[model samples]
Target: MTDSESPSGRFRIAISAWEARMSLWIETPTVLDKTTGETLLSFKDGNWSLDAARWLSDSIVELTLRKYPGNHLPVNIIATLDCANRTARIGEKEVQFLAEVESALDNALTWRTVTPPPRAARSGFASAVRRFFFGK
Candidate 1:
């Protein structure tokens, strides 16, 4: 569930990876304001690809928090190929937070929470409509 709809939406994040299992998992609540018409989302590996060896270097850890990326916009992230159950704990967080994106991630083909909120459930009914009519 990306923001219901917004006027000035944006996203940003900073990712510095090393070959290790300690992939940083950052999250925040209420990124969107229904009244403002503006959206902001933060996620891991914004515009950058993560190395599997580095993201999953250690199996013992669950999730780790990293420094915030500060201000930015439209950090479009591509989805991961092999999900490997990387999002089970993320669902746990969404369940705990009762986040808007939980349902979106639940139905996603890839690891839901690792990517940005906009990336979650990116292919929606609108996409199908666009493909059908516009042939995009």
Candidate 2:
């Protein structure tokens, strides 16, 4: 953590875009992993995926592995986040989900970004992967 950041990640969540400062995170306490914070994904056309995955096997089997993640997660649109009220609204829907914020951070790292090393010369496998993907 930086000198300005709290050891326990006690800081406000501020994401500013389009000249707007939206607060999706209050002082709910979260450790900001700079690795994840360095990269962000968006719905821009540049990020579009049009091709379908080709099947490898002719037969499909269902696996009951209790090790997967949830699909219907509580993702707020960030219209307004009232920390005092312990509530947030998603677009026009004012849904009351995640009564406790503790559970949010437990898996927040999964949704965070990882910081990439500087564009300067990097050593080893990471640099190889970067060159392969980024054609640097």
Candidate 3:
């Protein structure tokens, strides 16, 4: 793991197993909305990857839109995963906040609350029967 310090010295970023996967883990105190300077998210010494951050941001936006219907167009989350600085910014070109936008974000954070079905179940009955008979 190669560790790097941000210019602000607020957070540290590490790149682990880079040869196998180009994943960056960022240890930051909070993620903020660039325009509003509001704390959108906070972590308890949590290390999150850029991909995860992007997905989470997108999910929060989508959930916010569906849960509370309104005009929330062109609002996207941008992540800067540079070794020097690991940060996220909310880009709202056309912004309209939902009544329960915060609630939606909280709900989106519980993305893994529901467990997925097993591989066998996903392959269907025919695959299960074939595996049982063939001892695969």
Candidate 4:
């Protein structure tokens, strides 16, 4: 197992690997918030199959989340790599997904009590205009 921090130092990552069935099996890395000591994301009972063939060809890694803090985040994530092209894609909404993950982590660390938006505000602009015109 190896532990490291993201370049930004906002996240700590832990990874473990071993050999099995003639392949190198790597446990999906766990991600934690650096400041709060909270697990933002984790995976278990799953591993990446790294064989010589996979290294030379296309490959896919499926990850199952052991700890996911947000409703918006996925319990399962799929990452595909085009080894020939040296390109990769993980999940559908890459940017939005990362934003949601960070938001979930930030929410977990927030100390203040958050109040929901007022009902009128939640109803949307058209409803607010109607309420103003009808005095309802």
Candidate 5:
């Protein structure tokens, strides 16, 4: 996954909240890996901050398994940002979504552009199936 900068003139870090159908909120205090006693994230006030940015990245990734709780997880969720035009995306969906969000943000703020690595497109159904089973 690509690491991103904080939105224009804003803190180099930002916080966002993601939730599933049950409405359970994801935070640092939440269990990351129950079997391993790992916590998904650790926010001081159910929030994200610049100081916790790196930690949040790890935390959010850890959260995916629990939040999905199964192999075939239909990733349906919402991302709420503290700042307008900030970028966020869920799972592998982040590539295109980030581009869209970041483009809008850059236009709004007139920030200089930075191109992210191109997303890989599966060449065929067999490759797609392999990736699905092995998480390439």
Candidate 6:
């Protein structure tokens, strides 16, 4: 989901259909404290867009699952960041290790665990263009 509520809370995550098959993904989560109104996590991507939100969420879920195979991933893991005034599920009876959860997500992202270059961006168009421009 898009964290647009805070101007500085623009971190994002992304996953692709092809990547889904590989059982991998990517994401960046950022949270802003409601009471103090301070950004708790990094939101580096300023130009991040909504079209990427679905992918981001998917990536985050996949990353989390991959990183912590035995861990039970709650359906509302992401929404938990904004479930209430707290950026984290800290000191909660339900979410025991909120900080650890966030830390794992950051580690996956920081290490570039799953992000591979988009193949479409690498395909050569010069050959096709040459064939179209010249009969040879």
Best model number under TM-score: 4
What lDDT is reached at residue 134 by model 4?
92
Q: Ten consecutive residues with minimal summed lDDT in candidate 4? A: 49-58
Candidate 6 structure lDDT: 0.34
Query: Counting only residues 3 or more apart in sequence or on different chains, how many pairs clash (N, Cα, C under 3 Å) in candidate 4?
Result: 0
Model 2 gets an lDDT of 0.29
**What lDDT tens digits, residue by residue, belong to model 5 across residues 1-136?**
1223332322222234455347554432222233344322234333211212323432232122122222222322333232222235433344233325323222233223468889887778898899999986
Predicted candidate 6: what Cα RMSD to the true structure? 14.3
3 or 6, which is superior by lDDT? 6
The Cα local distance difference test for each model comes to: 0.30, 0.29, 0.32, 0.42, 0.34, 0.34
lDDT of 6 by residue, 82-129 (tens): 323223332232334334545543343322235667646322588677
Which candidate achieves the best lDDT against the true structure? 4
Q: Arrange candidates by lDDT, highest first: which order? A: 4, 6, 5, 3, 1, 2
Clashing pairs in 4: none
Which stretch of 10 consecutive residues in model 6 shows the poorest summed lDDT? 58-67
Residue 6, model 1, lDDT = 19
TM-score of each: 0.18, 0.20, 0.21, 0.34, 0.19, 0.26
Model 5 worst lDDT window (10 residues): 61-70
Task: Please identify which of the two predictions, 1 or 3, would achieve the higher lDDT against the true structure.
Answer: 3
Clashes of each: 6, 5, 0, 0, 3, 4
The reply for model 1, stretches above 4 Å from the true place, is 1-23, 34-100, 110-136
The worst-scoring run of ten residues by lDDT in candidate 2 lies at 59-68
- What TM-score does model 3 achieve against the real structure? 0.21
Model 1 worst lDDT run, 10 consecutive residues: 1-10
Per-residue lDDT of model 4, residues 1-136, tens digit only: 3565544565555665554446434445655566677665443334432111112221222223222222333333444333223233454433233324323333333233468877744377887898799966
